[model samples]
Target: MELEQDLMVSERKKKPFRWHVLVFLAPAVIVYTMIMILPLAETLRFSFFQRDTITQAISFVGLENYIKLFFDPYWVEPFLNSLWNNCYFFLIHMLVQNPIGILIAALLSMVHLPGKKLYRIAIFMPTLLSFVVVGFVWKLMLSPLWGVSKGLMKSVGVGSWYLPFLGKEETALTTLSLISVWQFIGIPMMLIYAALLSIPDEVIEAAECDGVTGISQFFKIKLVLILPTIGIISILTFVGNFNAFDLIYTTQGPLAGPNFSTDLLGTILYRTFYGQQLQPGDPNMGAAIATVMFFIILTGVAIYLFFIQRKLTRYEM
Candidate 1:
């Protein structure tokens, strides 16, 4: 009888606290499914169908949309252009933003820096602002009317270099990408800074005793320890850059104008779904585009995980 009672108690103990788990997880799971997973699945499904012209009825099209998207010159050209532009944007963030973030993080990690908290707060304030605000703020700063950029350049004896960057097809995309980098550099900075802070003082002290001080110590000791954090930051940047929309949309408008030179996958998806001046909206095509984007992002992430991340050996410090 005692054994039976103990077994019952043990079984009860082993049983999951169902209400507790539900309380902790239910809301997040529900919201994530409804907002992200469901919509994504529905969009993928919609990509495989076409709507009737007159009746507005959706019919199964299998690979027809994909076929057209790849082969049709009109669609293919813009699609490829946007894809390349998006790649450039991602590359710039990787090359420029991440390095700059590392440099800033390194500087902020220095113990002798005065008012470090103030500097951190100031630097990170931009990331806290909405994309719309950043876009508009940069637009004004770069505007000829305001002369902010020009004035700064003039002060440095390079006033003649100032041009209407956003109005030029050649520079528009790059300019917008830089603006985005400026706004979000804080994210990687903060992440890396935190990782740097988490490093043991004993390790740093030992390195210092070994005659590794200043930048050399940082490069050899601190940076090696922060590789895992850097990996995380890189992946986060990848996902965010690939899914980016609002900054480009706000700064360049939905059309990604200057003769569509700044067009990215996000803007293209928006234009296809909602239509613009000359083109009528095509939901099927839009869904197809979105589905393609999803695959592209997934493929990039997979490559990062399998190739780049696997090669990066993270040291426990």
Candidate 2:
């Protein structure tokens, strides 16, 4: 027994302490906790308290803010409208952007395609442009007077088709959504393109040997293999669209003008937090809205992880 105990102690001592791992990870861990975790916790804490409108005193109000948010028409109306717009924005991307990306990726993946590198760069270049630049450029291009869009339409012999899309409430949100799709479509295209390229040559050869070729083979094999990538892109789109603010704010201002037709949750949060012309800024309400946004993003990611991700089969190459 004594001999066995000694041997066990010797074995335990042989395992060296890995201080290097901790040293490498400490900076990132500390940074993340400070930047992300602490702020998130503070936001949640603020949501449950309220400040007196006149006295400027804060007091615990529990779920009163949430209740007011849901039941008060002043808050509820804009919140619902923004939420719906956000969903519509996400839907447009899912329907239009991703399908187009897949088609482009398919074409780009073709063997011996000419100017393939140039085409990829051209498509992706817009994504690197700042949102301020993109918004300003598009706003100018869509200007009713002396804008290239109008002139281009006339040149194409479809002069009647041109409208001030950004000026009209009905078309503003849709136009912006399409513009966003144009800028970021390259992301999905590149991701899907890489997934396609990663498929082993042996698999292609085997498929050809078995008489599987062309469009039919892509639908059956390549598409199936990249389902996991598609799922990831969908989740990314959800998170990004839900958090979208910059372009809308730049183009339409904090009012999200034309009767708030282009308002989104991010805009709502901004307006509520910062106050507008007549409205006083409500930090507690702003924090509540932010907390709700966090939960919404969390719920979406959780659904993807617990439900969607599990079902996607990542076939080994």
Q: Which candidate leads the pack in lDDT?
A: 2
Q: What is the per-residue lDDT of model 2 for residues 151-191, given as tens digits with 9 covering 90 to 100?
A: 89999999898999998999999999998998899999999
lDDT of each: 0.90, 0.93
Assess the local accuracy of residue 283 in candidate 1 as a C-alpha lDDT between 0 and 100.
91
Q: For each candidate, how many residue pairs have backbone atoms clashing (under 3 Å)?
A: 0, 0
Scored by lDDT, model 1 comes in at 0.90
- Give the Cα-based TM-score of candidate 1 against the true structure: 0.91
**TM-score computed on alpha carbons, candidate 2:** 0.95
Q: Which prediction has the highest TM-score against the true structure?
A: 2
lDDT of 1 at 68: 90
